[model samples]
Target: MSDKPLHPRTRAIHHGIRRSQYGEMAEALFMTQGFAYDSAEQAEARFIKAGPDEFIYARYGNPTSRMFEDRIASLEGTEDAFATASGMAAVNGALMCFAKPGDHIVSSRALFGSCLYVLDVLARFGVEVSYVDGTDLDQWRAAIRPDTRAVFFESVSNPTLEVVDIAGVAALARAVGALVVVDNVFATPVYSRAVEQGADVVVYSTTKHIDGSGRCLGGVICGTRQFVREVAEPYLKHTGAAISPFNAWLMLNGLNTLDLRVRAQTDSALALARALQDMAGVSRVVYPGLPDHPQYDLVQRQMGAGGTMIAVDVGSKAAAFAAMDRMRVFEISNNLGDAKSIVTHPATTTHSRLTPEVREGLGITPGLLRLSVGLEHADDLIDDLRQALA
Candidate 1:
């Protein structure tokens, strides 16, 4: 009952636990779609304004979902959070809540293909969108304007693993009174300083790291209470983007060991990346943790770890496929941040929708293969890749 702030690892497990009278050891799942009212008057009163513990319908909020939200908010150092059905729902809700026609938004060009599609959707609605090189301060400074409503970017971009300067971009947004919305999926909550670094809102595809075993799809938006409750909740609740109670319960359990899993994966990723660089078949190796990475200093200053992803160019599409076919330890799949190591060829799978020119611009080439390092032994993973490359 002490008021001393708990560390993130401890907070992830014990924070925001709302136990039933049974006082069950594990967090209880509330699977009901609706809560009963004491009477007609109480129902009307609840509709007017519900207290923290109260719930009306599953779409609006549930105890299980709220528990996940509170725990994530505590770890991310945000006032509140809203859970969503999927990662894309979280991304869409965060931006669509406040963006209106004619509003200006500047985003990094190097983003997941889906994120770029979302920006295109916004543009079709008359919102002006601009793309900038995320690692370049000059480009961000020029792209963000006085009238800009928001600036968005991934803290560490997908596939290519380009690290963006969150503080630098946030400072520019602050100058113009713009909101800074960051997708911090790669920089898992264990290493996230997004809120401290001036990000007004931080988002994660909890489907990735949070659900490390890949059991469910979920995401969360971390921000001030006003934004979560007022701006985002109203839009999300109405649009029916609520996550299922069962999924929320699974996500809560996922938070318990998130720190342990991410750290192990990140270490394995660093080792794998170093090994890839020495292989004769590898034409390029890109991982923020490596000293030769373009944004190596930024990764040290920002994330303090290279994270769990690695990008390797195996010389050509044919070579990349041959190596992937030969791999035994790594599985071929588009999903990252899993307990099982996953290797994805972005140019053909995740980023295939992008035009060839756009893919080239983002450095998602025919030979590029994204490796999401898992919880396996580092030496075993390296040997597997080495043999595959040979």
Candidate 2:
């Protein structure tokens, strides 16, 4: 193979490989839990210090999982990556690995409910977590402390679709010697320049788009080799958060078409956002691609395109439900980043766990609905919405 830089679509398919003796055309799944050695001495040496390509136990590493990790790491432009059982596992592992009791963490107020749980629950255990307006540079600067170990935020927040300035936040964190950990889900790998823009660590819930068909649940954390192998691997392997080989294989197949799927979905999303902007009963539309979005310029600079998700605020909960219920093509569900478009009502679903005051603070209103655009034809989706609104 040539050393020339390959496009993401090409890298997704060809970055990682482990050929068997027979040289199978597809990546073979090593489903076994353990690997065999030639001799007792070899096993002993492996236990002490395995070769770079060797595997001792499935918990620590597996061929299929390694392939998925390698492929994602290459796409994210990171030195290494560790696969996890789920997206939250990746989030918790990344934060807990570097955080200790009494350490401080700064995060954006706009986060998925589960992420808020992690940060708040950690606070109960003596960790200090401060929430700030992610779009505000001054808030981030004001929140950073001398002892802050890490700063975490979604590059584009959940439900509300707020876009945080990754470069600005990373620069602020770097000044205080804090690691910048970004959950770059909304900004898919197809549009992500997180690593190049100064993110110290990047995390993804591969279950969303990577498995475009929704066949499996998986996540990965990408960073420097030392951080992934030494810090995250040891904690994840021992805690049983390692991904299954089967799921990893499924994700690998999904990777082959990720760029294609995400781009198509993003196109549909932009169209949907534009169509909804002036519709009756629709109060506001939140899509990074839309010029009306508060951070439109930052999104253009950071992600190039608007992305594949959109959020709209109808007049009320009743109107939102009517719109969602009347739609023929879009499914009403909480999940985002799928091949099938999904609509979610945040106040009663994903963000319900938050107290009413907290939910209101995050702008997850009764009328707010999040839409994850898929590979459907833009006109078909628009027609469905038209009839639903009428």
Q: What is the C-alpha lDDT of each candidate?
A: 0.94, 0.90
Q: What TM-score does model 2 achieve against the real structure?
A: 0.98
* lDDT for residue 295 in candidate 2, whole number 0-100: 93
TM-score of each: 0.99, 0.98
Candidate 1 deviant stretches above 4 angstroms? 1-3
For residues 1-390, write the lDDT of model 1, one tens digit per residue: 998978899999999999999999899999999999999999999999999999999999999999999999999999999999999999999999999999999999999889999999999999999999999999999999999999999999998989989999999999999999999999999988999999999999999999899888999999999999999999999998889999999999999999999999998898888888899789999999999999999899998999999999997899999999999999999888999999999999999999999899999989999999999899989999999999
Model 1 — TM-score against the truth?
A: 0.99
Best by lDDT: 1
Q: Evaluate residue 15 in candidate 1 and report its C-alpha lDDT on the 0 to 100 scale.
A: 95
Report the lDDT of model 1 for residue 25.
86
Q: Each candidate: how many clashes? A: 0, 1
